[model samples]
Target: MRDPDAFYPGSRTREEWLAECAFDQACGGATITPGGAPLPGTEQAEQQPAEPAPAPAAPDPTTATIEDVAEFAPDPPQVVGEPDGIGVVGMPTNFVVDATEHTVTGDIFDIPVTVRFTPVSYVFDYGDGTRRETTSPGTSWQDLDVPQFTATDTSHSYGEPGEYEVGVTIRYAAEADAGGGWFPIAGLLELTAPTTVIRIVDVDTALVERTCAEDPSGPGC
Candidate 1:
């Protein structure tokens, strides 16, 4: 067994000179208490309940779903049609759409979040009992360096003449940022713009003696 005096500083043998040095240099001449007993008031500080583990760190934005940002979804795309509200039978009438990415701030599961909606695709309803889906938002003939009525990917020829209601639906993919970088949300959100009314008319041609430009009131003018 170890000697008790060797373990206890007070009972251990010490030279007179060493004891004098320790008495003058240690504890600022105050009484010293040993052992693991915490200092007064330190016990309460150490038992402060650990700050609740930092509140579980609100969920990562990556876990967000499309439904979470549904309410903040972007508005429908802007639809523009060539010939501006009119078309000709057997002639292709073009269509175009415009959409921009936008962000909205709202709460998801009680966590503040910012969501961005980006247009991904366009579905055009020509209102002639036909629908076409395309990734390209049709460009105008002038922009394409092509003549008007020329058939393009987004242009459609009317089988008959009448008044038609044209419509477009835009598909939007969403991303969320909850104080962190953006992350893609699952699924897409679709929204439809107001319908545009178009009138289709049939054109008739006849041989004339003079051109319409030559004569102010020429035949078939």
Candidate 2:
């Protein structure tokens, strides 16, 4: 008869080899008996079925709405100029204004998001039936190195004397970021600043022969 020890390659005995083959069959692998015959259940164990993977998560519906994006809209712009009053009638009054860039960060539907706002254009309403639009925020006459009443991009002259309600509307553009590159929002937004009341009056000039220093408040001294 052929020797059973020659069928196995290792130095294990017959009983040890049988135990190893039984362990391999339990672990979903093929097994062979000491006599070189395949085990009855080894093939079925080796072909055990696999479990299906879990499905992916669904997207949030709130993040796709307009109201969600509008929540990140910028606040109203601040109007900068002489708060007390302005110059007299026919004078070149500079309507200076400025708007700084701002950022808002928060979560949208459990997803982190960031929004940025920047001023793009300025519309000035002088309250005298005249309106002007410009890219600059305008500067004072002294800053522009020019004399008063000189025509400038943002300077306006009051034709008559009265109280004018000066107001400005600022246009802002928005951009969004969600762990990716920045992209522009669908539409532009406009914000109007509080109206400013300024008094405009006509100045009268007089010429006198005597000096005003001696007369104190006499005549047009």
- What is candidate 1's lDDT per residue for 1-221, written digit by digit as tens? 43221111233222322233222322111111233223335534335565563333334445455677789987676677788768899999898877777799988777788887766667899999999977677888889998888898888888999988889887766656656444455556778998888889999878888888899687766
> In candidate 1, residue 53 scores what lDDT?
37
Off by over 4 Å in 1: 1-57
The TM-score, computed over Cα atoms with residue i paired to residue i, of candidate 2 is: 0.62
* Candidate 2 lDDT tens digits, 1-221: 44432223244443444334322322212123233323335433334347554443344322233345667766665554442366677777767776767789876667777776666667889889898877666776678887766778876889899888888887665555555444444344567888777777788878776678877787864
Residue 22 error, candidate 1, Å = 82
Residue 117, model 1: lDDT of 77
Q: Lowest-lDDT window of 10 residues in candidate 1?
A: 23-32
Clashing pairs in 1: none
lDDT per model vs. reference? 0.67, 0.59
For every candidate structure, what is the RMSD over all alpha carbons to the true structure, in angstroms?
26.1, 27.0
